[model samples]
Target: MTALTTREQIVTTADRLFYENGYEHTSFADIAAAVNISRGNFYYHFKAKDEILTAVIAARLAHTKTMIEGWEREAPNPEARIRRFMHMMIANRAAIKRYGCPVGTLVTEMAKLDHVAREDANKLFGLFRAWLGTQFRALGCGADADRLAMHLLARSQGVATLANAFGDDRFIRREVALMEEWLTAAVAHATPRPDNRRRQH
Candidate 1:
């Protein structure tokens, strides 16, 4: 295989180290070693581990946004669109099972030490929540759209954290199931119950 370019090597190595270890535990030395570059050469591309981490965070954010957008496009209706969003999260069960949402993980771990990192993390969460708010409104989710949007975001991240910490599939399955149930309730509650719609005897 063609060797990965230096920048790609650095990013790939950083991604793995940061995900497996953490932003705080990972260091410049680890990155240099992982990329097979000396410290001097590594410094040529990145001044500090923070710079590399910023790049890694940016890349992950872009990747996530693109994935969520693609899922949105594939959705056929408001409810499916919402369920698809949840399923898209379910698809990440493996990653969640391993590393958790990188942005959420990093923010919790490094937010105090790194303002820039925290800002980037906030951007990722804000984008998802905003997109969800717009989607819920589009689906006529009424006054509860905002709350429900926040709830969905919280539940997704919370489950990912639990999965990562506990190393259990039950967290992933149960959380996604709860999200699906909530989506159904939200949709039903948003719409007026028609008198013509009769209940089963």
Candidate 2:
């Protein structure tokens, strides 16, 4: 594999550090050291912490778009595609229990800091919302697609936050199962049933 460039390395390292430790808690020196580069070299690449943050967010956006595309290719069925997103919690439960979710934590930290990149961080959520909305639309949700997408995003974040707080694997598993059932119900309700004009109540 081709090695990541210096700037890419710095941004990648900062992304991990910022997720592991809140943005404000992690310092320039920390990221520099983590990347095994001097502060001067780090500054040469990322002049300010926020600059690094912007790069990291951009990288995340690109990576997420690519992932969503892969999901599209891998699961042509919208419901199955949506399940892949939902099942991430169960698949990454260990990390969720430890870190609360890389996206959620970063977004929350940015909000609390009133950081300039808060909206940029939010666009991460926006990506999921829009993609899931498309998937819902494919499932024939029509006008309710975006709302259903947001609902799923909200539900997953809530589960991630509480799962982190409680570190309960069982709760994570149960919530995932419930979310799956919820998706099935939503799809069922969204679809138009065949006419039952002749059937008795």
Best by TM-score: 2
**Backbone clashes in model 1, listed as residue pairs:** none
Top-scoring candidate (lDDT): 2
Q: What is the C-alpha RMSD of each candidate to the true structure, in Å?
A: 6.8, 6.9
> Given candidate 1, what's the lDDT at residue 52?
88
- Candidate 1 worst ten-residue window by lDDT: 192-201
C-alpha-based local distance difference test score of model 2: 0.88
lDDT of 2 by residue, 68-148 (tens): 887777774788889999888898999899899889999999899998999999999999999999888878898999999
Instruction: Name the Cα RMSD for model 1.
Output: 6.8
Per-residue CA lDDT of model 1 for 1-201, tens digit only, reads: 233478778987898888879878888988888878888878878898778878888877788788766756666555776787787657777887888877687777767675667777688778878878777876677676788889988888888878888988876887788888878877776763222322222
Model 2, 48: alpha-carbon shift in Å? 0.8
RMSD of 2: 6.9
**For every model in order, what is the number of clashing pairs?**
0, 0
Q: Which ranges in model 2 have alpha carbons more than 4 Å from their true place?
A: 1-4, 192-201
